[model samples]
Target: MERGTRSVVRDRDVCRRHGVVGVLVEPRSQARCAVVVLGGAEGGLHEADAVALAQEGFAALALAYFGSPGVPSSLVDIPLEYVFRALDLLSARGYASGSIGLLGGSRGGELALLVGSHDERVGSVVSVVGSGVVTAGIDYAAGRLDRILATSGAAWTVAGRRLPHLPYVVPPELVRSIERDEPVSLRDAFAALPTGDELEAISIPVERVRGGVLMVSAGDDGSWDCVGLSEVAAGRLRAADHPYPWAHVVLEGVGHTIAGPPGGPVAPYGPGPGVTFRYGGDPVLTADARAETWRRTVGFLRYTLPRETADEA
Candidate 1:
């Protein structure tokens, strides 16, 4: 698609030579910056969002860490190195390490913050409805259902070692509901987790991030306590006196799924069949929040990772 003088181009084979599963989108003209886009527990390449960013004159890569042919089958113990490979690919495309940003939503949001904290190359981050601490992964296989029903395993790893994580405490009723394939809200399970000094050990250590951070959450998130988690990250940044700009935004009356890009269908929240999840927010309000969140995200990225001027380009 044409965007003023620059036309958008997509390269599905952009990272294939490096054994990375992703699609790269950018303007035919030199891009201003680069961003790595990640999806949540739904697990897939977020190509649409990447294309949207590309239309705005940035090089965007929609990476798939799981639920793809070449990656892990599920969300368990995904290696951070996999993401680094994507960064390396972007770097090879002439984007400086300092010009790269990470954007993610829900579980992907948590992954983005965690990655930014570990990698100095990341210049900016936008985490939507993500967590401030490491949390257990989800395994859907019937044989491993017991493990998932309890604490399960860590969602991420580095150098083949699992990171410390908080475990979910599922109640008996919720377990029964899951067994019966009934619609269930996992919010109660998350609320049942202990809130104490123990959490400090598993915290994301946001102070280590080398660039600006923007944490976005919904006030009425039914999937988990996103607002509280975002606060935890923001508080850490403030306490460290982070040199880069940082802000936390809370969209009231919206739920866990509040990061949709603009110009898309704003469908009402309605769970379809067995084991459906509820996000908790008015349909109209959630639609509004999605649009607002996208605007804020774009503005934040522009501030933190500004595009090159005409002379530089």
Candidate 2:
């Protein structure tokens, strides 16, 4: 790891070099917890976020399942086993077993929940603007929501196969066009997308998750209906009477740009320079939500993963 100042040491695609994939961030000193960070369909390594977590005294890995070298060019056909491989690498490098946590944004958020539910070793899960059930990756054409949804392929892969996924379907009236400035009804879109067998096959069983869970959602998400989706995630956990500690945070004015740790720009226009429309929150509100959610995320992980490993405890 190459030392950056005194707080973090960055290993650039150290995983790829070692026949694994993604980047790993480590604290200069010993860390109490380990975290895996994931980004959305836009697909870059969550290196900044992982480094931020490392700065908070946790070992962190920014895992990229797609859109990076040695990984899939898109979210299509990604093996679920990649996540397990990341955990195995962290364990081999001295992060404690079963003390690992997952933090994901957007599509990553959906995955964090799925992985946490499937693996007992995951100590906690933090999702930002995530989906409750499996969702298909829609290739946005200059077409209507319903038209594109019917044609978009599966977003995730498992055991070398694709799992069923919810499509992005909205009635024509509710969604005018993707390129224009028009209001879309996320609720309507989600309601249309959740196919019976598809949702059943891919929905994460929150009751089975082996650790604490935290979900952060924005009420007016432009990218997807994260507010609706987050509520669905929490609702499932509650319906299951989940034994593990869990909570949900709804930011009233914010939208899809709520990724990143505390101390970054508020980003009213979503992420990047080309963000033409409002994601959801105004600058002040989005900024505040970003800081607050990140703080809460760290606290939740600390509560679940202590200085001593779970096995030792």
**For every candidate structure, what is the RMSD over all alpha carbons to the true structure, in angstroms?**
3.1, 3.3
| Candidate 1: tens digits of C-alpha lDDT, residues 1-313 | 3242247788877678767899888888788789999998778888889888888878899999998888887789899999998989988887876689999998889999999998888889999988887878876442333346464578899999999887777678876876786656666666433466776777888889888899999888877788887787887899999999999998888777787596665443335223666677777888888889998988889899856733475
lDDT for position 158 in model 2 = 70
Q: Give candidate 2 misplaced runs (Cα > 4 Å).
A: 138-150, 170-199, 263-265, 270-278, 310-313
lDDT (0 to 1) per candidate: 0.81, 0.75
Give lDDT tens digits, candidate 2, residues 196-220: 6655666767667778899989876
Error of 1 at 245 (Å): 0.8
User: What TM-score, over all chains together, does every model reach?
Assistant: 0.91, 0.86
What residue runs in model 1 are displaced by over 4 Å at the alpha carbon?
1-6, 143-147, 179-182, 191-197, 263-274, 309-313
Find the 10 residues in a row with the least total lDDT in model 1: 265-274
